[model samples]
Target: MKEFDIIVCGATGYTGQLACEHLARSYGSELRWAMAGRDMAKLRSIQARFEVPSHVQLIEVDITDAAAAASLAERARTILSTAGPFANVGEPLVAACAHNGTDYVDVSGDAVWIRKMLDRYQEVAAGSGARLIFTCGFDSVPSDLGVFFLQELARERFGAPAKTVKGRIRRLVGGLSGGTLASGRASIQAAGADPKIPQLLANPFALVPGFDGPAQPVGNAPVFDPDVKSWVAPFILAGMNAKSVHLSNALLGWSYGKDFTYDEMIMLPGAEDADSAREAADANIWSNVVRALQIDLKPGEGPSEAELAAGSFEMIFVGRTASGQEISTTVTGEGDPYALTPRIVAECAVCLTQDGTTATGGVWTAAAALGEPLRRRLEQRAGMSFSVA
Candidate 1:
């Protein structure tokens, strides 16, 4: 009997609907999956709109209801969640999945919450065989996996790992999702309530508990890169992505090197212009002002299909070996980050269910848990391209 191969826990949300649409289009009859949320009517409505296979189930369960979440977790081999501002609604499902030995994936980029999950559930999930992976979406996947891809090449070409890798966002044309904004607000509130939370957020090694490597480059300031020939500014997701990369390095027994150094920034195209350089330097401050005004999208709101279709992103990773041999690669994708995230999250869950990774349970990053298998899935199954540049 085919129970659900995967369960999408927030199927009615904007991103959730995109995931369902992708699953319906890609796997229809081949995969047994379900749409789950607190509202049966909403789930059923989304189910009808997607034209998924008749076998696709609709599950009604509130994140707040521990029993319902646990029961749902027990029925599926993997649970892929798009629910976020995860600090509020994520723990119960993590607890349920850890206890049930069911694999789980989420697109959350909340490092603070993720750190707590690692401390509380990593051992339990490891003991129970539940592989909980986070930041499966655009926020950290490209950054994490870009470094992974570079290190793999370094070992192949130079017969050694790259000691330093840089992730630079070349281009990104997309709007932020309301869920992302909400999460940002929640994180700020958390940091304000507890003074130490900001320190955790600022720590380059926050995710790699008990091990701190050498001092990392401060990517928060704008600087010119001689190699890339462009001015770079702090990438907003750098801190979170750095933590994920370091965690992956730790999980892989420090194969990337105990002294691995990573940083991320956004490339400023017109940086030769003095005005543009100044603007790039102040981008983070201006962004914060905008966010403080709370003038962004709300939950269940997002770009139109045309806008989503037109959006795209390109990321470049530059790897430098101990001997200073450098190699570069670019990861590019079509569609908005929000639109693409669902596919990424869904495919990750499918990879876990069908491929049955050799990785033992516990908290995992995309590169550490899925690695080349995920890279293949993204390139082959999703509309993404990765190439040496």
Candidate 2:
């Protein structure tokens, strides 16, 4: 099949633009990549603004057009799709990629959509040798890769895997792109229309591979678990990220231990200090009120150049091995967390193409193919670093 090394679909959108910029800055000379979208004019505009090289093609096609999508799949070894809310408008592109044996990646955190995709496309993908990796961005990448890193640490330190892994966001500060906000609004609206969508969200297995179990109530809102010595909240993206890590466990088999239980939480700053914890609680109350009013505290279309240069976030993954060894690793990165996601998604496509990971294309998640490699790259090139403690 004729192909560019990477094809970034939805490259004209906000997150898509940042992704293209990051890719160009990092791999422009070495990688043959291009910009793509439904609007050729918009794609051309982005190309002109960025001064994209001649080698990078502009493939304009609608994600909804199956035939055109198939043509795109045939033209690119790897495809990074920033088009979403995936539950609404992502399947056709996925189908083309599976059929054409092209590796696919996206920044989707939709559990129900993932489940549907796995059911509909997994077999075709397997036959075609396509790898469809999803949620390779802010929503789940940090957690997925954190799990992988922790498990690797467990093996190296204790000669066995951790029976339980916990990922707590120690601190997060960033703005969301308009695209992400729109996706979330759409998800909320759709959920309001379909009650099941809202209910299924609480189920951890909602997006997990090989999990067809009926839904049940979420166990409990997280509280201070003295065992882990951290206060926790119901993880906003747990349904997506937790399942991804589990799927990786299933696919990679021994990389992540059997009987592994994973959970995520937002660790409010000063959770351990009584005064700071009280202040945090008050802040959370205010934050919820603002969200209720739809006032986005982290306001921005995306990060500024200065923020991209100076912005950073950190997350620590805590692991407890079966042998009682405690391990932790920290992952840090630059740029607005949400804005940085699209770049992560775009880079995933490039990495998958270069790495030549073979998979029977079925629905997949970041943890399955690009998890470890991404962690490495995040450390090396993305102004992100990971280290064991």
The best candidate in terms of lDDT? 1
lDDT of 2 by residue, 297-372 (tens): 2312555667655656777778887778888888777776755686677667767877655555676667667667
Deviation in Å, model 2, residue 169 alpha carbon: 1.0
For every model shown, what is its TM-score relative to the native structure? 0.96, 0.88
State the TM-score for model 1: 0.96
Residue 143 CA displacement from its true place in model 1, Å:
1.1
State the weakest 10-residue window (summed lDDT) of model 1: 284-293
For each candidate, the alpha-carbon lDDT, in order, equals 0.85, 0.72
Clashing pairs in 2: 122-362, 125-361, 126-360, 126-361
Off by over 4 Å in 2: 209-222, 225-230, 271-293, 296-300
The TM-score of candidate 2 is 0.88
User: All candidates: CA RMSD in angstroms?
Assistant: 1.7, 3.4
Q: Which structure among the candidates has the greatest TM-score?
A: 1
Give the Å error, residue 110, model 1: 0.5
